[model samples]
Target: MTDPELTELRELAAQGDRDAVDQLVELAGERGDFDELRSLAAAGSSDAVDVLVELAGERGDVAELRRLADAGNQDAAELLAELTDED
Candidate 1:
């Protein structure tokens, strides 16, 4: 996502733009939906998995990253490992 578009989506999300939040998540993946993405792995939403994985990559939020990983989101799990590595 471009900086301006990303910024716009972030602002929209902060302003309660549910559609924008969904778009941000969908744009981050292939065939991924917004509602399912926010629900995480509980709903078997891989798109949500992909979105969360993408978010973890960008934000490096270890807790969310770990949760996604534990929930069996492979991409998210890998990203969490990379982001939270001891190195």
Candidate 2:
């Protein structure tokens, strides 16, 4: 994505815009930057949290999933349960 698009997405995402949050998640995923997603999730973006949970679960990142779950992410909690159950 261009710098302009990223700037715009950041502005909109800061306002909790769902579309902007989703776009940011996709961009971060494509760039393999789960840290950015984690940052966004920490800022209370449910969309970011969802994407982070999905990616962490797919990568079997138990630590990341557990952190999110401990932070009270319902999706993370659910996915963590499934992942642990599969063990």
Candidate 3:
């Protein structure tokens, strides 16, 4: 079940409340919502991009990381490099 607080935070984040967006990013990270994080990052949220890159790297999500890197996200590129280096 989704946490009530997260649901509320997501609602506020969707409305473009920066603080709420930041909170949602934190909560999403805690909940391991990689897809949501990726969506937020794609929407141009730098904070979300940071978290998304970290999570993607941790989860070994090469495709997602590659997508972000292709979009010129430096952090994603670095993380993807690190991940690929492990091969």
Candidate 4:
């Protein structure tokens, strides 16, 4: 997205637009933008958390999974356990 469009979307998201939040999560996931996803998740987007967990799992990023798990994401915790079992 262009800078202006991204900024507008972020503004809408900050204003509690659920659709905007979902769009941002989709964009972040498509770009593999972990920081963006993390920020969205921190702002209470469960969709963002789900995407982050999926991304971490796909990349086999145990540390990221652990961080998400520690942050109280149940899906992340479950995935982390599954990954640990694979070791």
Task: Rank all candidate structures by their TM-score, best first, as comma-separated numbers.
Answer: 4, 3, 2, 1
Give one digit per residue, the lDDT tens place, for model 4 in 1-87.
899999999999999999999999999999999999999999999899999999999998999999999988898899999999999
TM-score of each: 0.51, 0.74, 0.79, 0.92
> lDDT tens digits, residues 27-59, model 2?
887776888888787777776777888889889
Model 1: pairs clashing at backbone N, Cα or C within 3 Å: 37-48
- Which parts of model 4 have CA positions greater than 4 angstroms off? none
The runs of at least 3 residues in candidate 1 whose Cα sits more than 4 Å from the true structure, single-residue gaps closed, are: 1-36
Lowest-sum lDDT 10-residue window in model 3: 1-10
CA lDDT, every prediction? 0.65, 0.85, 0.82, 0.95
Two-way TM-score contest, 2 vs 4, winner: 4
Q: CA shift at 37, candidate 2, in angstroms?
A: 0.8
Best candidate, lDDT: 4
Best-performing candidate as measured by TM-score = 4
Q: How many residue pairs clash in each candidate?
A: 1, 0, 0, 0
Q: Report the lDDT of model 3 for residue 9.
A: 76
- Residue 62 in model 3: lDDT: 90
